[model samples]
Target chain A: MTLYERLGGEPAFQAAVDDFYRRMLTDERVSRFFDNVDMDGQIAKQKAFLTYVTGGPAAYTGKDMRKAHEHLWSKGLGDEHVDVVIEHLGATLIDLGAKAEDVAEVAELAESVRKDVLGR
Target chain B: MNPDRTARPAEPSSAIHLKGRTIPLAAGESVLEGLERAGIEAPSGCRAGTCCKCMLQGEDPPAMSQRSLRPTLRAQGFFLACQAYPIGTLELSSGEAPEPIDTVIQSVEAVAPDVARILLRPEDSFAFRPGQYLDVLHPSGALRSYSIASLPSDQVLELHVRRIANGLVSSWIHEQNEGQRVQIRGPFGQCFHVADDEQKRLLLVGAGTGLAPLLGIARDALEQGHKGSIKLVHGGLQPDRLYMRPQLSELAETWPNLEVEHCVLREATEQEHEGPLDQVAIRLAGSLENTRAFLCGDAEIVRLLQRSLFLAGISSAEMFADPFSPASP
Candidate 1:
């Protein structure tokens, strides 16, 4: 089974997505990127990102990731911002009762997209 | 296990009706796949139901397709195309305006400095929830939306319209007479109260004329005998902007479970609390657990309230909103 299914699929991801988004919105380190954004639309994007990192079926491509973050580059998005997201992904999974090994795997998967997300 | 052969008749195969074309669904094929097979470009993402990007409205769609959406969206016939497996032919919602209904103005009274309470009686039978909004079609073809402030049992449609400085539709509505005829359509929106849990506390916050839908919802809940506490906080630029104080005060007196509070940004009267709306509302809400919030008024302030309340502990699913944006010329 894919890690997505092993970790409880859609319902489990629903719970994790809200927690993950709350953390990002509340965290001063990365909250600036979300100003003037619609809450529902941002939540949907977060859910898609969570699905991609957890090895679920996602329509996102590396090119899409680069384009999505392209505008944020001028606002000082870089490796540090990517690291903050990765850290939050791991923390969210751990809080949701994910095994340590699974959280590590998810973090590794998230890191693989760092270059694309930061337009490196 | 014995297979039942004579207990039930064979059901009809499922098909999709879209834009005057009928497309049959192959066995095990989803509605999205069927649309794609028929050379139609349907918006979709993450073909698995998690993304919720392929939502479409349908008549009597499968319950399973709407499971992940909120109750209000589901009630509006929205379903995820990727998850739908309709057991019967389903008619899709084309992006066309519904037919307008003719109504006669029953009354029009100025409730505040710029707000008018206009009542209308539809010539034909009309069905709508109290908090849902409808479009008023101006004689010049401009359309504007207003939320229903009166329950259906009142036998008339009530709207609280705040006249914008140079708004065409609002100006026309404010100048209408009691016997005048008007055209309206819709009853759109998903901001009404659902009677799912009688014991769930309701926190309704509105600014300026946003009190229309909240008043409808509060009345609907109380009429349904909601046992949980309901707190309504109405805010404005100043105390003069807050209308219907006497009516709301009498309502609070009638229902022990309902408590009404008025707030303003400045010039606090003895009866009004003064501060930023979001801060005042969060402080008055006290405990946020098990609370469902209905936020209304301008888009920016509604967004602020939504984020603040969500952060204060209300679940995203428990919050409904109607954020009005200015009608573009």
Candidate 2:
């Protein structure tokens, strides 16, 4: 089956992301970043990101992530931040209801990219 | 606007709602037409099949192009944009490549400001060990790979998305149809599943949407109720730009063994610090013993983390990652 097919298409993905972030806000460890973030915008961007990447009708034709993030990186995006991002992602999948095998595959992918995301 | 009440679309595959960024391509039009339409200045050494520098991804797979891909690879779905014509909706990911890894888009959604959280699964069922990636099927047919954000054990899949201006997919996503469809495919590269489980602590790093895959790892660790302590470092711009905070906070709230530290590179109206990811790496120095690191996100940030980790005495084998960006042009 196609990846889209395997994911149960758009709804499944939407639900998964919703479940993913809902868990983030209350997590004492990483919720600080979202202390005053806009709730609706967060939902829209999250959904748009998923819709665009997963081949749903949506397209993420916004600013490049690097440059958009350049401002933040310039401020601070160290190994610690990256770790929090990764851990949250894992929890998201579980909440969104991903299989354990799928979750494991995601963790493995994160480790390989540490240098690029948090390295010099 | 009435939703679900709006008639369910018929022939979703054939009728694609054009976003503002779409380029109109006519017959005999080169695959480059879509690039030009999206205003992406693709780097093309040979617009023909020779140099292959122009080799960008197309709107969708089954898109045939020249160069970059061998016939066998093409048979598997890789294509050269310059040599190919526009088929349907063209997607360009990774400036050059075979389709990066074999993949097909699973779903799409816009969860927050300028961020689209995509949940993708590989099309080919090609085995990825974990912590690895398949190039994201960028609309212009570019192979932009992202780490698998969700873990293998988790039933659902996930990807973090923070918008990029002028970025074909990012911009289009920031402005368009909430339910539109896209095309993505892959399960490329390797992974970082720790078989030994000997390490007592797991360190994961992510910046912005880079946290997509790390969510997979932490969730799994928490599920097994593994005794190892999990420390996560997450960073982003202003609080409005904080992605995945809800989920991370909840986990930290409930789990005693998991600790996630949150930082911001951008305060509401001001920028601060050199870079949080690097900052985390600095603090992690010498404390790297018996810890496995999984990192993903924007390329520059990942590179910074990798170097720091190695210098901190973290073994190359113990560290794993999938760089999210590299300007090919």
Candidate 3:
């Protein structure tokens, strides 16, 4: 089995992300980040992203991390945002029923992107 | 030509065409150097041969300049599209290493606490066998490697990753968001799957993060209707250390051949068995019973299993193992 298969490919990850962002949209820690954002486009990008990140065959051809969140840096996003992202993502996994190791893999990925996502 | 002014000696030269420009490439110069010298962009990550982002296929298959390119991959036509320069007037194309792909891409999404999944979508017509890995790049230009967790058939590429404490790239992802981008290159490594070998009973063994590849193989098998006995042994230090129990349980319920077992060596510490994993090989001798086994985990565990299994009369040819680099390294 490949990583994509393990992550349950499109359907499973899509569910995870859908549940993930739904929680994130209202998340007090980072809800402001989603204020003006397009959930549809964000979801679309995230679907492609989570698919690729979880070992599926997709590519994320989007903005660079620094440029994407230079605004957040100016707004003072920190490890709190990182924690919020991870926490909500874990909840998303639970909602979608992602496995522990799978969630662990996601958590690892979260940590990898934390610095840039947090804009530190 | 300015020998006295240069600290390093220049080697032989080859001609290359990039973005419609031809430049002289030194014999030892990599495709990356060739492009860099010509002032054209060439994709690369983990120039160390471990990352497959610079993968290319053309008149000549790319060759890994370093032995780090896994053996199964080298047998297939993988070369560090970055490491190799044109030996001839080579037309070049590339896929991510481990697998295969084109272009460079990255966007951030937090998939789990401590795990922010960085998406590396490939360009059109990416080439890769299922189950290869890739290396992710950071704004600071550091490199971290990961595996493609998605099926090879999809247009987009996916990966599953875990965080290393204070890891350069992992830390970056956890803080990033939907539109945020980072450098991504690859589809490196050997395929963990063989085309639905129905005659071969399939046994998947994973330890800790090692389960990533096994997940890929199992999904491929189930989707294809491969009718082999599937038994997965995923052991952690303690039961709580195990992840994916629910998912595995669900899959087992659906597949008659699939049975998942969890083992714990101790209870207090979070560290899972990188495995003495020798126990797996011994366990396999009792259970493998002529089955083809796919093994992935720490190097020590993998090796220990191989030695024990071979002696236990399971033919060495029947065993497939993917060994990970040390955690501290």
TM agreement with the true structure for every prediction: 0.91, 0.44, 0.47
Candidate 3 lDDT score relative to the true structure: 0.61
Query: How do the candidates rank by lDDT, highest first?
Result: 1, 3, 2
Docking class of 3: incorrect
Categorize the docking of model 2. Answer: incorrect
Interface RMSD of 2: 18.2
> Which tens-of-lDDT digit does each residue in B125-145 have in candidate 3?
555555566666666657766
- Where model 2 places Cα greater than 4 Å from the true spot, the runs are A1-120, B1-112, B120-130, B138-140, B152-156, B173-181, B266-276, B281-286, B327-329
Cα lDDT listed for each candidate: 0.89, 0.56, 0.61
Return the DockQ of model 3. Answer: 0.01
Of models 1 and 2, which has the larger lDDT?
1
Q: List the residue pairs that clash in candidate 1.
A: none
Worst 10 residues of 3 chain B by lDDT: B95-104
Best model per lDDT? 1
Model 1 Cα interface RMS deviation (Å): 1.3
Candidate ranking under DockQ, highest first, comes to 1, 2, 3
Which is the leading candidate under DockQ? 1
